[model samples]
Target: MGRKKIELKKIECPKEKSSKYSKRKKGLLKKAEEMAVLCDSDIILLVFSPTSKPNLFYPHSRPLGRILERLSNMSEYEREERRSYTKKV
Candidate 1:
């Protein structure tokens, strides 16, 4: 039998919501790290919690400031060009 699809809604209980958020955040951070290493590219992930606390993830082997500076220096067109090139097979 096929698996049942879970309804998408905000988790009501605070404890359950926190637990789910923690688990999912950990998994997302792991994937971000893997992608940075596998692609040999600079990647930054910023997530804010309900409390407005920020969490940042990037390739630890690379300088975080350098990555941010490079990203900040990129023009909007350059950023879009890079994304387009990457999307092309």
Candidate 2:
């Protein structure tokens, strides 16, 4: 038999929700680190839980400020070129 599918809704049980969050958050950060290393690229992930707690993940070599600065310095033309190239591939 196939695995059961869960309904797309908020988990009502506090214990179940916390357990799910802990497991999934770890998985998400691990994948981000793997991708950054494998692709030789910068990656940042920011997540907020229902109670306003924040989580952040990024490549160890670069700081979040540097990434934000790099993005902020891009010109409109450069951004457009990048977007076009991504669409073509």
**By TM-score, who's the top model here?**
1
- List the candidates' TM-scores in order: 0.76, 0.72
Q: How many collisions between residues are there in candidate 2?
A: 0
Candidate 1 lDDT, tens digit per residue, 23-74? 9999999998998889998888999875678998888899999998998899
What TM-score, to 2 decimals, does candidate 1 have? 0.76
- Checking candidate 1 for backbone clashes, the offending pairs are none
Candidate 2 C-alpha lDDT tens digits along 1-89: 99899788889898898888999899999999999988988888999875669988888888889988998799999999999999999
* Local distance difference test, candidate 2: 0.88
Poorly placed runs, candidate 2 (over 4 Å): 1-7, 76-89
Q: What TM-score would candidate 2 get against the native?
A: 0.72
Minimum summed lDDT over a 10-residue window in model 1 is located at: 49-58
